[model samples]
Target chain A: MFELILTLVLLVIGFVFGQIAEKRHFRSIIQREAETRDLLCFNERRIPQDMFSPHVTLVCGSVVVSVDFFKHFVATLRNLVGGRVSAYESLLERARREAVLRMKAQALAQGATSVWNVRVETSSIHQGQRQGIGAVEVMAYGTALVPR
Target chain B: MGAYENRTVPEGINVSPVHPLKDFAVLLFGVSLSVIAFVIVLALLAGYLVRYVPFSYEQSLVSRAVAPWLEPSTDPLDQQRQRYLQSLADRLSSVMNLPDGMQVTVHYVQKDTVNAMATLGGHVVVFQGLLDVMPNENALAMVLAHEMAHVRYRHPIVATGRGFAVTLALSALAGIGDGVMERWVGQMGILPMLSFSRSQETEADALALESLQQSYGHVEGAAALFEYAAAETPVLSLPTLLATHPDHEDRIRRIQVFAQEHPPAMAPQLQPLPDYMKSKAKSNESQ
Candidate 1:
């Protein structure tokens, strides 16, 4: 009986807090993206020969986001049904966006005008067993082009 | 870079626009519903298949596992008590029309727990605590017959099989989640199992009441056993929904309803307990 009550309480807390946190993070990401709009990013490897003396440096940003209890529960359920696990969708979305934003910030800090050949990679870091704490690490790396 | 400009993509493109709660509600409802349905079907299949297992198999299995522990008492008085209870059970079974080759073996236990139970292999155990509280032989017959009814319906085996299947399946499903999810899944499985047990109890009560009416031509004292039980234990305090057995008050009400529906032809007579049984009960109380 105690376990049942505790599970219910944890579910409610996870859902309420997780929802609030996701909403707030999304708001922050949108606002930050608007502020950093002029920092250009591209997947193209070729650089123009006409471009004036530009300093090149490698820039990278990485972030790890852990799953909330409610999303974990929903995902466990989804495992049985074999469907699109929407519970982790927004989680990865946040991680991927955050990684890019951080990479852009790194380039801007170096007085770079644009990033070339940007790349993003994601991998899950399992803390313990299969059902234990789960988090995803996303790393965005690119070459920054700064005019001297 | 083409034009060297990064256009701001509109929101809600990558992430699904479906609200989290809506997705959660749908998945929770659909997944749990299917799991519960699957469990129920498995339980029913197990219970149905178990009934096909020969009663002799159940008897042999229990004899190997449990019968040795239920050794008959060596004390002369205790043996006499066991014999008397056994005879009473035999008499009730004769009128109750128990299926051929099925028999009830009554074991009189010398304890003071105020409890009686029926188990596999048609074994009904009557504790000394329960015997001491009997108001009359009629009430004793009601209690004995109730256990006999459980044996008649093969409830013990059916319940065992059902519970085993459900637990095994639920535990396997629970392996997909952590501690909290495991507990939650287990609790869901138990609800159906408990309800099945409660319905079995109700079925036994009805059959026992029928046997009581047949034996005494009236069920006037049938409710006495539950009344005595209710007085001794706070069993009625538990919520009826969760308990395996129905509340004592609910059982008494059922007995009263049965009696009212099938009026006896003659005046209701509650038989007094035989002198040896009464003496044995008194001796236990004194000790």
Candidate 2:
């Protein structure tokens, strides 16, 4: 009986806090992306020959996000039924967007006009196979070009 | 650089548009319903198929576990009580027309718990507390016949098989989650199992009433045990849906109905319990 009550309480907490945190993170990512829009980033590797006195360097941003109890529970159930786990979808989206926003911010701080060969990578840092996915790390990296 | 520009993409494209809660609700509903349905079907299948398993195999499987139940008592009075109870069960089984090779062994427990149960291997354990409440031998026969009916119908093995299958499924699902997930899954599984068990109780009751009519020429004392049960337990019982046994009142009403349909040709005679069985007060003092 105690375990049942604890599960319910934890689930409610996970849902409420997870939603609030996800919404806040998405809002921040959008605002930051707007602020750093001029810091162009692309997967294209080409560097323009017309630029004078170009300074090139590496810029990267990475963040790790963990799953909440409620989403984890929903995902576990989803595993049994074999369907799209929408709960984890938004978490990944938020993480990937935030990583890109951070990478753009880093380039803008370095006075870079544009970035090239931008790439994003993801890895799951699991507690263990039985313990489930504890967190995911997303990194965005690129070559920033600043004109001197 | 001359023509390329990083245009801001639209929001909320990567993630699904469905609300998480809505997704969760649908998945929970669908999964729970399927699990319940699966368990019920599996239980029914297992229950039906388990009777084909030879009774001797079940007896061997439970021989070690029920060893304590079959242990002989050192006290002379207890031995005498056990013999008397065994003789009564033997008489009941003779009239019950149990299937060939299905033997009923009655064990007398000196404990104070007012309960009796039919378990695997055709072993029935009746507690002293229950015998204390019997107003006559007919009431005692009803209790014994109810358990014997469980054996005759192969309910113990069917229930065991059903439980085994259901637990296997539930545990397989539970392996994916931690303690909380396991508990949640177990809770969902319990509802169907409870309903199945209640129906078994009702079926056993019907058979027991029939056996009582055959043995006693009427079921005049068949409801006496239930009367004691109703009086001893508080009136506030769990609803019939949640209870393992049918409600005491409902069981009594069923017996009354059965009595009306099969009236005795002569005045009903309620045989007194043996003198040794009469000392409910003495048994408690000895304990």
Candidate 3:
């Protein structure tokens, strides 16, 4: 009787410990981004011809989050979550907002009226077999047409 | 308190039956513990079996078994096609900045089936039927790019690992029941391969677009290529393939959105076929 009771207790304890371990593993993976910045570039043809400011042209900009940083965050989060729905949503929202703000800043810097056809992308840099990181990455880019 | 004590029943009436209750509790506890112990033993046995027999050996055995069943196509242009494919692969390697000792091989099958595929270890095969329908070099490059993307992404190996785990699990389950196990093994053997192929196709598409933007300067060709494939091929209608890559329209929309957002770095310089090859291609078209 004592042996039976002890076995039952051990089984229950094992199940509880398993659940706790799984949850802790999940929490560790669900980390948030620490810092981020935009990778910027400009193109001359993206602006309307009518907008004229001497020595000024449309500034087309792109944003590339550090592939290493973004991947680390994603992998850690992926360990906790089964699906990418929540993570991708957070990433896309942040990327879109950041892209718009950066484009506006570029336009203002050039003293232009507004930017047009702003776009964003998510891409990855593929390196192989690194620890605690994703070989895949996400990158975002947009076009900002300024005066000239 | 004194009035309540005065109202108490006789000894037998007040006392409970401890023996029967204790016996029932002990029996229930014993049965549950036995079941738990049995499950633990089975689990440990499974873990031991897996540890002893390496998964790679099983994979190779399966691969060899399947190799005999796969139908090989016979085509006359297989050699010339191979040469052209090699040249294109060389160009892609240089453009993608791949490391030394990496090799790519292309196969041309004579089958009239409208299909093209890339397997692991950099083997790419395209059916004559698919080639016959392609309108231009860019469209062809789109297909090649998609396949190359599979290689670059290492999707095939990942897929193989997943397939092995699923197969092993199913086989273990089926081993317990003769009537159901046979049917299940038969079904799984056929279905999993098709599903894996389909998933690789989708991954290739996504990676191919990324590769196109990075190497060729735009994804316009990739989008057009997918549109063409959707129109020309009915392979997507297969149940197993459909399960992996559903909604052609969704894929098109996603690719277009991606292309729009990440425009190519520079305008792509189209590479024209050599004069002799162009003439031969024209003659083939005329025929």
Q: Judging by DockQ against the true structure, name the best candidate.
A: 1
lDDT tens digits, residue span A1-148, model 2: 5777887898899999999998898888888888887787889887777753458999998999999998998988888788688888999998988898888888888889898899999999985667664689999999999988
Q: Report, for every candidate in turn, its global Cα lDDT versus the true structure.
A: 0.86, 0.85, 0.50
Q: What is the Cα-based lDDT of residue B168 in candidate 1?
A: 84
Q: Mind giving the per-residue lDDT tens digits that candidate 1 earns over A1-148?
A: 6776776787899999999999999999999999999998888788767553457999999999999988898887777778788889999999999999999999999999888889999998895676676899999999999988
lDDT of 1 by residue, B1-287 (tens): 23568899998877767777787788778866776777789989999999998888899999999988899999888899899999999999988998888999999888876778999999999998887778889999998999999999999999999988888888787667777667667766666777788899899999999988888899988888778768877544657777788888889999999999999998898899876675465576669
lDDT of 3 by residue, B1-287 (tens): 11111121222222232342243345334533543344334433543445333434433654576444434435334556657766776666566654344455566666666667766555677776666655555566768877777666555555555556555654664433333223423343444445555666777777666666666677665555558767866864654333655456667887889878996677756554343223346457569
Which sections of candidate 1 miss by over 4 Å? A52-54, A127-131, B229-238, B274-287
Q: Write the per-residue lDDT of candidate 3 for residues A1-148, one digit (tens) a residue.
A: 3543554464455445533553453333222111112222322335445543455444544444332232233323233224343333433344444454555566556655544445555555544433322322333334443444
Best by the TM-score measure: 1
Arranged by TM-score, best first: 1, 2, 3
| Candidate 1: residue pairs that collide | none
Interface DockQ of each model: 0.62, 0.59, 0.00
Classified by CAPRI criteria, candidate 2 counts as medium
Clashes of each: 0, 0, 6
